[model samples]
Target chain A: MNRRTFLKDAIVVITGAALPAAALEWLDPRQVLAENPQIRWAFLVDTHKCAGCGFCVKACKAENDIPYEASVTRTWIERYVVTQSGELLADSPQGGRDGFTSGSIDLPGGTRVSEEEIIRGFFVPKLCNHCASPPCVQVCPVGATYATPQGVVLVDRQWCIGCGYCIMGCPYGARFFHPVHKSVDKCTLCTHRLTRGDASACVEACPFGARQVGNLHDPNDPVTRAVVSERIGVLRDSYGSRPRVYYLGLSKEVH
Target chain B: MKEYVWRPMYVVVLIAALSLAVRFFLLPHDFGVHEGGYKYGYYRLGNIAEWESRPALFRSADDCGDCHRQSESLSASPHAFISCQNCHGPAAGHPEDPPTLAIDTGRDLCLRCHADLSYPAGGRDAVPGIDPLGHHPFRSCVGCHDPHHPRQEVQP
Candidate 1:
């Protein structure tokens, strides 16, 4: 082939290959909205109803494939002991898996106190708040963590680089490194079950009906109604994460 | 154009082309900022499907009520609100290969909620708790109390 013709053909071939790649970038699909736009999931916990049975913790471990013996849990119950002298003691033994059977409250530095000085105590169940403005999502450099339109925050295990930034960013200390998956893991609000019109495993496992999940957009939802009618509060409202989990009868002693 | 200028321009263009090509293949097809816009954050669009595909291990009490007559006995009792799977373990597969599910009859099982820590507030007082040592030391709860009908004694 002539030199001039060969140069022209080479340029054309390169242009042709590069054109498609450039076009594909522009043609990339935009992420779609949630399947049900009207549905926003919210959680409710009745502090008065939680009996500290630890059934929810066990059920969550089983349902989510978290190791039963793992020190971390997707859900856990904390017993708060407020003494007459204004000292606050909080402890969660084995994440309340076996319940609080001890008469003494053990402190972090090995100090222990008998129940005699305690004036009041209560069990508070905690999990991922699935905040509307989740700090975890904000701090995820790789975009592995995100919030669903339904208000549930989820971690994309495959995409997570295991940087642990999201775990540190969380205000409630909700996220944890999975012992097996080696990625930052937390509660998904049982997105698998919720999508199928069933309650989250923890909610269903609560015997006294302490935990509940509901559609915030649906005014008729029992949980929504209770939230509207009851004097409920979220944990650490000052953080402004706009947490979706609401607690009934939340005491001032709780952090 | 000068030869020196042309050579530098060519090198820059080639590197840009190579980088673009690599990114096109490395980026996941389903990764992007979702419906809530940038404030809500970006994630793999397919992760929703991945999460939804996980099998539910725990089932509701209504699922058990469909087969076991003992469920009826529980409804009228104080334990009605509790799911069978709570104490019975996740009902992922049952009454087929295993034929029957194992029941937790340990004293610790019952004492989990009933053991008296004497916490006077925050609804702990609602469920009556007993001093494990003072009440029935080292005895199985089911020996006398019927779990299905917790208020009633087991007939000899």
Candidate 2:
């Protein structure tokens, strides 16, 4: 074949092969856009009941195979104790998950203090709020993040350029930059497990049932029902992200 | 004859242009952020310097590990997203002669940001004040406030 004819054929073949891979790598727009979402609302962590067990934290790490070196966790729990005299105290001897404080990270003022102990101290787990207006998606120039019909904010890691804008923009400080890939990362709501009609890894792994996740659309789901029956509100109301996650009897005092 | 002469020169210029274009796109800006893993989180310990006029902005948590090797795992915290400066203030000039990097009294320092800023008008009114001197007489904010996680929903 002459140069023109040969070049045209080569271009077609190369682009044809690259197109599917790119889409799959970026985010399978067709597959994602086609599927019906299952999750609607989400669970909340009551800091009062948490015992600083770190079960959810460990479960999340083990379930997702999250590595401490770089693959930052999508969810983690922290320990806090309020003094009898009304002094708010923070302590995490075990990586800020459960009640233990074993692991060490290079953080400022990160050392755990063991002076005063209060029975009132509790563990609190934190994760992505899965906002109705997910800021991560809005700020992403490449359209890497999207919201599901069920209102879960999911990201197409393949398409993500790993920019940290989402990390900074999140009011709750839920997002993190992947150490190695240099891409942005956060809790996925366990879409892999949820798709299989299973509970979230964190929920399933949690021994205390501290985390409860279910379909907000399904009125029968306990989480959704409790939200309506109890009148729970979302976190950081000022953010106006309209988070899908709700808390039952969540205290207004703990902004 | 004219086409032959112009074609080679044109091709040479185009190739050079293409090479230059490659350099611009494949390098730092296109990749977004600096090269390699973010060092701010874990890996080591000690204080990191963030002087206003210094190039030490990107120094990670390892710099601070020198003194706080005990907190090496702090890099693993759930609140690892927070920078050293946000909690303990700046880590200017290593530990300094007299140790300026030490966390002074008051969780209010952190509350200034973490506190609910309801009334920007009455600055302190919106903030949940820490009665350091009156009640607990705590040394630092973390004394009671866990920076890694939000407090549990305190039910009425």
Candidate 3:
């Protein structure tokens, strides 16, 4: 064969082989473009019901298979202590996994206070808000993070480059680099659980029924009913992330 | 000289066009997410399938109720809305190979909600003021009230 024919034949074989292999590795375009999505899920957090038991944090770590490390929390509870002087103090030692002491705000090797100094305090649990207009999804360069049809935000671990852009963009400080997977990790809202008609781990773990996950599209859903009837607040509503997690009895002192 | 120069250029163009044809032929059939104005297909295309490979970590409460029907009494009480797993921990391994779940009988668990706070003394919150010291000092609240139906149980 002549040099030109040989070169031409070689290029064709390589291109033919690579195209299908590349296409198989990504999210299906059809699934992404499906119109008229019927599902819209939301998380309702009743801060009033939260007792700072920290069971939800422990449950989350166990369910998600996250390590028992302080820095890599997928969910954590914040005990907000607003003193009579109107000063706010918040902390979660070990994500409150071992639970919290009410009378004295005992942080891990940090601060301690007597009941005399405190006025009122409450616990606010934190996790991926799964924003409608998620900044994390927007910032992900590889399109690894995406919101599902049911409104759950998920990270495609295989596609993630571990750039941490999504982590930085998350206003709730939910996303973290996975120590084991070495991929960008955050709460999936437990999509695997939700899809099967089960509640998220944290929601199920809440002894007080403080946390709930439901489909906002379904009017009859208890969570949807509660969200509509109750005056709900989102974390940093001004940022316009449109967080799906709704909070009831959220103190003004909480951020 | 002209034949030699032009022939190689023609061959290069042919290969480039053939590569484009292969890519177009192999391109995914469905249009993916809509970007600004146009559609961009095949963006992270196989992720959905990949995600489906993992099993669910949490089981539905209904799964627990299927076998442990006695626990359904919680539905009639004030704690009706509370999930069983909330107190028993994740029942991920229940009914098949049951995992030993922790049962929280501690006062701290009960007091997280029952304990009074100065947050304007009840609007919608079911929280009632308790002195803990005066009402039942050094006593577990579960001693008197059932965790499921607090009002139904009488104080001993």
**The best candidate in terms of TM-score:** 1
Q: Candidate 2 on B28-146: residue-level lDDT in tens? A: 33232211122111111111111111222112334555666536445565445444433343344546543654443345444333332221211123224433345455455555556
Give the DockQ (2 decimals) of all models. 0.50, 0.02, 0.17
**Considering DockQ, where higher is better, how would the candidates rank from best to worst?**
1, 3, 2
Better of 2 and 3 by lDDT: 3
* Ten-residue stretch with the least lDDT total in model 3 chain B: B34-43
lDDT of 2 at B106: 49
Please write out the lDDT profile of model 3 over residues A83-106, one tens digit for every residue.
678777777777777666445666
TM-score of chain A of each: 0.84, 0.74, 0.81
RMSD of each: 9.1, 18.1, 11.0
Better of 1 and 2 by DockQ: 1
Worst 10-residue lDDT window for candidate 1 chain A reads A26-35
Model 1 CA deviation exceeding 4 Å by range: A1-37, B1-3, B70-73
How does residue A145 of candidate 3 score in lDDT?
A: 76
Model 2 lDDT per residue over A1-255, tens place: 999999999999998887865566755755674484444657765443443344455556544545644436677655444544765655433444332322112224654433233324444567889887776656766545555545555554555677667677787787877665456767777665565455665665443445788777667888877777876767788877877777654544444
What lDDT does model 2 reach? Answer: 0.53
Classified by CAPRI criteria, candidate 1 counts as medium
Better of 1 and 3 by TM-score: 1
